[model samples]
Target: MDTIISIIVPIYNAEKFLASCIDSILSQTFKNFELLLIDDGSQDSSLSICQKYQQNDNRITVFHKNNEGVTAARKYGVEKAKGEYISFVDADDIIPENSLALLYKEHDNADMVIGNFIEVMPHYSKKNKLYSPQVGRFNGIDYISLQLENKLYHAPWGKIIRKNCFNDDIFTTPRDIFRGEDLIMNIKLGLNIKDIKIVNTIVYYYMIRPSSCMQSRKPTLEYEKMFDRFLMLILKRNKLDTKLKKSILSQRIDALTGLLTEKIHLDKNDTFVKMIYSQLKISSFDMRQILLKTCLSHPSIFNILYRVYRKLSSITT
Candidate 1:
């Protein structure tokens, strides 16, 4: 029997990018694979587009579900998949044509195979060079550590994972923590992977749309639960390294600053916020790091000034 790969895409209202995303996967050099398109109750014409493709392609399977969310959609896909290895693609992104073939080649020996990505902006594209001109394999624990530190990606889109490595519990994701779901899942899944193969070759195209929720969301208590969960996960570890500790601190600072930037009217003495502030021993290097992170969030002069103003307003006596 051929080694079949399952490519899962959780889609909502993504009419414009849906066709291209599907086409890229269909055009993959590897042939023995199933394309699972989970339509998470889209109001747009996304379902019709998926059905049209399904009629002609036998490998395409379309599942229409009520609007749950990406994490739920992915869990449903995992339950239905019938392949030796699994991979993921975002509805708004494009996968490289040779990605499946490349990953499949290394799947036999590695529990997970990772490929680099290209960030596609409206007018320009940037090639992602996660590593310098080479391919290598490392222990899965190391990969998880790097990913948690934000040194490598935590998203599951660019990986091919062995199906047998995970138990059913691995798919469970907290419904409210949308922002950090990917990182959480990757960390849990990474624990099961004994060996990981990383290829520097481009295997995915990440589409950067103009409107991003990260720029506008208020990030209430429920939303901020991700940061809390992250802290707990890191703190519970028996062997906490210095790099991971810094990553936790960075996340805490980012969370606090994000709320401040949005001018959220939360209690000043809230335990979580107070704990984060008390722990913030911001060195010169950390200040520079914060500035770099803020700049990367948005480049508009008004945005920069607004954030700076809000940040200062919080400290006013």
Candidate 2:
């Protein structure tokens, strides 16, 4: 029998948390789901553990491919998925037992369903527990607005998308330039589809291990440049409304400012530095015009730079 949902999990060197991750899925209250474990060429015992699970459960399908990135692994799993709805789970993260059940129940008349998540550190530490401050229903067409307005985060694990959402024009695309690929993909998905549902339930447990890519202290500039590429892609699309356009550009400016600082600290002359600088020139002024939008969306950046930039731009303008 075909499953209702396909839980796509891309695994690398996740030996430490592999069992917990798999066990979480196995313990899901929704029984009509299959776990697609794609082993992205792990040099550790992760592949063996995946094989063990495959042996234990017929619903678990294991795919062993050469060391490809998460994007590739997910694409591979989607290609083989036989479920109506598709959900993603990181190899190190766990989900609530009734998470899938709730998401599926709330998936009525919507293209995608998004849920809440908690940040789980390696050990129970006060520093690792950061709950997102923004939460609500999103009725805007702007993908970046949803992002800027705190309607959604660039997390694939917290959302369940229809299988059709990963069709050829989307999932099979050759674009991999963005570090926040999930953001770009979700943006495209949001634009293409109209209905999106938000379920107010904390479903996923995000593991904040030291070696996690997003948590890495010394992340490379390429990852930072992904923000720039995402903005450029949105601008070139040229189909969004005025509000969305301004919001997207404003959000891009804010994101680039942070990326530039990170680059300045990490590498003085990374290849993307010049391009980002040029973008800043154009967006810096527009950011001032859309000052209210930026001020409300990203208060921290606005508080520090608002006075300084307002004074400097006033002199220049």
Candidate 3:
């Protein structure tokens, strides 16, 4: 029997929180779902934990594979999934019991359903207070625009997508880049979806750990540059409206600015700094105009000015 929904979790060295994550899913109010836990060469107890759960629950399926990245694990899980709708969950995060039920209820006549999420820190929890659209249906372009504008998040874990919206041919080619893979995947999926439903309910609990890749300070200029080029290609390929294109460009510029600011203290002659300078040149027309007006024609000048501004702002605050 085909399940109504399939939840795909890519597990890698998540022994600390794996059991809690699985338990949250098993305790969901909506029971007609299959859980696919893909263990990506975890050198920890995560595989044993998954096996323990699989022994008890028939709906839980575990697949162990070599050390591929999350993208490959998810693609493999999608291939094995036999559900009408698909959802992704990070191995260290938890979902409310009513998550599936609420999302499934609003899946009518929609290609995707999106819900809100809360961020759980070490000792404190913060709800994402971003303004979600009212409970209504939105077209693909509008949805993409909202995402680029940061009104909607680009993370894949807080949404449910119809399996039909995916093209197997495109999905099979796993992305090699790591930094912005979620945003790229979501953009690709959004291009295929016609209508999406937004639900203003907090369904996911995103745990913020210091050891996560997102928090890593290691600089990888090549991956970042690849992501920027990929975003540019997506913008060029999609027949988006003027407003949407502008919004996407603005988002890219903002990301570049943030990255530049973070690396401003590094040596001006560093390779990473040089690569970022080159990326900024091609990021967008608006960014270039801003740089020109700010008298930051050179990357070193820009970095110095930004660092001084940050210091002043911190002192004032």
Candidate 4:
């Protein structure tokens, strides 16, 4: 009862699992928490369900706003949250009964508490825990490096954060970042976090709904926006050394390569990506950027591959 945790569930057409998600929170072993259900222009009965739950539970607060995607909904909830600590839960996912209690136990010493989650698929479930290198509390530049280098879990769920860790300026320049919003939010949040604890216990049930899958992204103007937005965050952020910068470059290249696996598109984003290659410093390219663990950094090599890949795939229009 000393420091109540605020749990925010951003809802957008998640009516099917909304009830169960709410029930899981209501049945938490730790009761000293506030539940904020933010309905982001959901077309289904998600808002109604939230209203019904709020009618019965005094701690439940329901808010409705225009559909501005998950990041905006999350930002709205954070603005309204009154607790010292905050946690996010996708309305389609569920949290364990002791999840709040587990995260709460570490609040006094850590700026954030991140727990492993089990990915519940149709046939099986897999637990996600920390590896040896990611087993301890991290702070300052180390925290940023771990997060940017993909050393820590990027999802906002399964993590309890000190409310003050959120930097509002990151949200000032609104941009639609596809499905990478969670990682982007976490990247921004990491800058302000002084201490973060990674726990071994399972805390969330990330239900892998079969219908939740979407098509792979093309390197279109939209993709450019997402990448540029992330790059802006990196360049604008202060205190980043050579090591951290390389980590971010590696991560971005990995993502770009992953996208190219599905399909390569000739869009305006390509020009922007070329700039990224120049920034990496070709003179420092050790055996095709093997040092950075990136696929292709040279503009000519990347262009040749992209052109060949495009022609081979026969992608017109």
Off by over 4 Å in 1: 123-136, 211-216, 220-226, 230-247, 253-317
Superposition error at 67 for model 4 (Å): 1.7
Q: Which ten residues in a row have the lowest lDDT in candidate 1?
A: 126-135
Query: How do the residues 181-294 of candidate 4 rate in per-residue lDDT, one tens digit apiece?
Result: 666666677777888887777889888775566555445545654665665556565646455767776566556555455455423246656655555654674332442224
Off by over 4 Å in 4: 1-3, 123-133, 216-233, 241-243, 265-317
Best-to-worst lDDT order: 3, 1, 4, 2
lDDT of 2 by residue, 1-317 (tens): 77889999999999999999999999999999999999999999999999998998999999999996888898889989999889999998999999999899888767778888888776545555544524444543744567653346777787788887676545433454534566666666665666677766888999877677454344445655665555556646756645565565455545545543453342324555443333344354455535434433444565466667768865754
* lDDT tens digits by residue: candidate 1, 194-277: 898887778888877754324544587546855677546544662544545666666555565566556554454677655655
lDDT of 1: 0.74
By TM-score, the better pick of 1 and 3 is 3
Evaluate all candidate structures by whole-model CA lDDT and list the values in order. 0.74, 0.71, 0.76, 0.73
User: Which residue window of length 10 is worst by lDDT in model 3?
Assistant: 287-296
